[model samples]
Target: MSDFIAEQDRVLLERHGLASYEALWALTLEAVDEPNTERGGWSSVYRLDLGEQAFYLKRQSNHLTRNVLRPFGEPTFAREFRNIQRFKRLGIPSLEAAFFAKRRINTERQAVLVTRALDGWSDLQGLLESWPRLPGVERGEIVTACGKLMRNLHAAGQLHGCFYPKHVFLQRSSGGYAARLIDLEKTRPLLLGERDRLKDLDPFLRRTCAWSDDEVRHFLTAYLPIGTDIERWRLRLDARRRSKEFAVGAC
Candidate 1:
């Protein structure tokens, strides 16, 4: 369409031997200017203004780290793809991810993951950094949303390996409150009948004893409820714990 988008398409095709996200990438760059003011972490966040579709584009920088990996630092990009697809299937209220791109320049090959981007959404970590004490309806909404998110993830056979490590942020949405799972790069879906499914809790439960009883209670409260299907969660959580214990004793 535009010269910029067209040029990007060409570069992507030539560099990565793939041309999936060229237009999307161009759209992000075109909508952003030095004056727009961008906010992000180490990853390059492209500020976009698509009228009613305004967003802040996210992509993994070729050189970036800090709890963010290309999913176990694996080149497949399958983890990221599966998460988006699974969330969409579970009807989870999350930022929509679009196509991703793979590109290379010279001897270095790089991957570019693209998503619809978020404009108003804030991660739980950021929100809690401001409001630690969630009061009244906010607290209930947080509990509900947290439980729902976790349920959806587990239903999709995914284990979110980290939850702020005992104390993380909680996001307060306009209509309700929610908790954002930090370090999503550690996510892995339990493959059906796969033995590795039992190993999924290794990362999350490794420091279980580090969690204070109160902290653990708070998390369980947020994650378990009759309406949210407490029985299912308990079964899975206990199964995970038992698997870890057995693995340790076997060695």
Candidate 2:
């Protein structure tokens, strides 16, 4: 069994008897989402509230992903935990893992990951729903922040495999809006150059229907270098969008 508890959260988790793999795996809490039972394995997320603080606890059993590095299989949460630490080291804003543990019992593998809740942050989807009511400056601030976050992520040679609006979170900060990413289970190193950027950005553009052409241009302005051909990039994205639409329609 291997486990890690962030020093700041050690006392609280210890107090709740959740400092070990067995304790966290056996914990019962309100589930936040439906269990994902895929690849003959299962995973679920739960909301754990302790006093005024809140945390998210994720549990999985035999949920494995086979890769070149680990041809056999490894717990998905293990990858996620490593990515969380990597993001922190790279100065990327992301979830703060409070505790992470994994263990093997016979042929079964189980893992748990806990992260502190972003108390004041709101998902980009929720913020977009109220975009009309927000001040123009605030909207621009958020768009710029989002663009910068993406630029930073890509520049660091990391790709957020799933870059949907819901996975991007924002909070009002002293400078402006601060952006953070979550649901990094699919995150991997960026390869194939610009193709990797398109892979991540396409889905985000498709899902965020609230953005107008002007808003998109503004975002790209913030994302790209001063002399880069933004229109060409937009064309490529549009072509990809159409291909996606056609694929879905054909299905």
The candidate that wins on lDDT is: 2
lDDT of 1 by residue, 1-251 (tens): 11112342344334433345555445436334343112121234566444354435444434322335533343233345456556667665554544455554564334455454454456543443344454645645654565566655665666655533232234555777554443355566556522343343333334344333444345456644445554454477667666654543121
Give per-residue CA lDDT, model 2, range 70-154, as digits (tens).
9999999999999999999999889999999888889899889999998889999998889889999899998998889899999
- Maximum-TM-score candidate: 2
Q: Following a full C-alpha superposition, what root-mean-square deviation does model 1 have from the true structure?
A: 9.9
Q: How many angstroms is residue 244 displaced in model 1 relative to the true structure, after the best TM-score fit?
A: 14
Off by over 4 Å in 2: 246-251
Query: Given candidate 1, what's the lDDT at residue 117?
Result: 43
Count: clashes, candidate 1: 1
Question: In candidate 1, how many Å is residue 51 off?
Answer: 2.1
How many pairs of residues collide in model 2?
Answer: 0
Alpha carbon lDDT of each predicted model: 0.46, 0.88
List TM-score per model, in order: 0.52, 0.93
Angstrom error at residue 73, model 1: 7.6
Residue 116, candidate 2: alpha-carbon lDDT: 93
Native-structure RMSD, model 2: 2.2
